[model samples]
Target: MIKVIKPGIQLTIQDLGRVGFRHLGVSRSGSLDTYAHIIANRLVNNHDNDAVLELTVGLCELQFECDTVIALHGADLKATLDGHPLYPGWSYPIKAMQTLKFATGRGGSRAYIAVKGGIECPEVMGSKSTDLGAAIGGFNGRALQSDDIIKITPYAQPWLYNKGALTPPKRKVIRLHQGPHHELLTPECINAFCTTSFTINPNSNRMGVRLDHNNSQIMQHSLSLHSLAVAPGSVQLPPDGNPIVLLNDAQTTGGYPLIGHVIEADLHQFAQFRTADSITFEFVTLEQATAAKSKLDAHLSQLKLSLNRYWAN
Candidate 1:
């Protein structure tokens, strides 16, 4: 078992997410940084779909009730285990009663924690991911709180230790594809959207990230848009003339004008962005977007093969 000493700004259990229910208005609420979540699980010999803890704006504290092996990945959370600094992307053994603490670090906005057998949380709708908006999954369907005891499997497994952490791309350029309503934007606005850099606003969250174009708001010819289906990565231009990028917990439908959709390959990096982070947008064709996804898949496959070889030793 693991106990939450401090829940930090926001902490919740997540898996790949609740899939195939979007048609019914259920959002695919899961870890904002999917790449980190998968890497943490892989390091601990856990399946990619296993439930893990997602820490947003780390300052979390946790204690182990039994001997276990675990892995930490994503943002440099400045995590320490038993007073010793812990590194990301490596599995470590923990003794019973050991305490682990984390502080906010640079480079990213979230972190992920994975145990050997994954977090043993009750699954809802075939997922362990927390849906904060609907309050339907994860631990009590809400953010973790102090004194919350999370169940951990009592099994051990072979995992690589002292492995090198994968370096995530730090490029601020995000590639996107034309959205359904891309035509609504004026020609000048389109040029500005593609060329200008935007800073993330403090209002960003799992639902959506509101962007500030440095006071140069993006304007569209149409002020009103009909409500339509939206998903994670959808970039909507609201009436306020600022673009909002919908995220994991965003509503299924939005009324704002859709200007573009960030490609899936960039979603992980996009999720790590925090307030004041500057990002530039570039448009890509569907072919380019599909190729990018293929490249990501190839990398993941290679990583899995390497981990399997290491475990066999």
Candidate 2:
């Protein structure tokens, strides 16, 4: 068991989220950064789908109740375990009653914590992800609070993982895939969208990461139409001209004119961006997008095989 001392700006338990309930207006409320979540699980020898703790904006404090192995990934939140600095993407043996703390991180906006057997919670709609908008699933369907005790399921399987941490690549240019709605943007606006350095808005949240393009003309070019299917990374230009990238908790459909979709390979990097971060966008061909996704998959597979390899005694 783990006890929450300070729950940070936002603390929630998440898995990969619900599989296919978007037709009913369900939002995918899983970890904002999926790659980091998987890596954290790997460090702890947990399954990819295990429920883990997602800390947004850091400043969290947790106390362990028993000896266990754990891992951390995503944001460099300046975390410390029992007064020793904790590194991301590495596993550590946690002693009973040891306290773990996180400060406001400078690099990214979100962080993930994974334990050996994962967090125990009633799965709702076949998911343990917390949908804060709907208030269903994960620790009574709400964000974790101070004094809440999280139960951890015990796993006794013998496994091996590297003691060293994986270094994540940093990216500034966001890759996008053109959708049919790309035609909605005027040719001038299209160039502006790609050329301009958009700043991440302070109002960004799980629902969407709003971008400040600093140009109002982009918003006037689009007219409202029927609501179309929207998913994570859908770049929508509303009346304000600022483009909002839909994320895990966004609605399944939206009327906002979409300029493009962020490639799957870039979602993890984009999720780590914080307010005021400058990001330039470039649209890529479908072939390029497929190749990028394949690259990420190949990397994950190699990492998994290396970690699960047998070690000769």
Candidate 3:
């Protein structure tokens, strides 16, 4: 069991989230940075979709009640274990009753910590992710609080020491594919979106990220459209003209014009965008998007395969 001494900005146990229940008005409320979440789990030899602790911002403090292995990834928040520096993309051993803490640092906005056996939480809708909007799954369906005890599920596999850091490139140019309403914006607006840099709004959250651009420089124009099915990474242009990138906990449907969709491998990059950070867009063909996703999938498969052999031995 791990006890939360201080649950920073937001801390929650999250897995890969619900896969087939989005039609019933459920958002995919999992880790915002899925790549980092899965990498942390992989480092600890856990399943890719195992529930791990998602720590947002910083200042989280956790104390281990038993000896276990843990891995952390995404957003280097300058974490420390017993006053020793612990970095993302690395796994470490914890002694019984040892403490871990985090401080504000440079990098992404969130980090994931995965224990060897994953977290023990009541699965809802076939997932163990925390849906703050719906108030189901994960530690009573909300951000963890101080003094919360998180139990780890039992595992019998022999512990293996795997040392490697998988770092996905931090890209300011996000790849996007044309959406159904891609033409809703005038050609000028589309050009401005792809060419100019937009700063992330402070109002952004797990649901979606609202972006801002200089009003005097770019035209704030978007044609109205009826509400339709929208999923994570759908870049919607509201009437006000600021683009909003839907994320893990975004609404099931949106009426705003869907200008583009962030490609799969690059979608997690948005999770690390800090307030006021600038990001540009790059329009990609469907073939390019497919190839990018396939490349990432193959890399993940190779990573898992390399570690599986060690564990099997």
Model 2 score (lDDT): 0.86
Best by lDDT: 3
The residue-by-residue lDDT of candidate 1 on 78-128, one tens digit each, is 999989999887879888899999999777888899888899988888999
Clashing pairs for predicted structure model 2, backbone only: none
Model 2 lDDT tens row, 1-313: 9999999999999998887999999998898889899989887778999999999889899999977788999988999998899988888887779999999878888889999889999999999999999999898999999999999864444435446456457689989988667786788778878888899999989999988866657545646778989999898888677898999999999987888899999987767899999999999998999998898888788777777762322
Root-mean-square deviation (CA) per prediction: 1.5, 1.9, 1.8
Candidate 3 to truth, TM = 0.95
* Candidate 3 per-residue C-alpha lDDT over 94-128 given as tens digits, one digit per residue, 9 for 90 to 100: 87788999997768899999998899988998999
Off by over 4 Å in 1: 156-160, 215-222
TM-score of 2: 0.95
- The per-residue C-alpha lDDT of model 2 at residue 206 equals 90
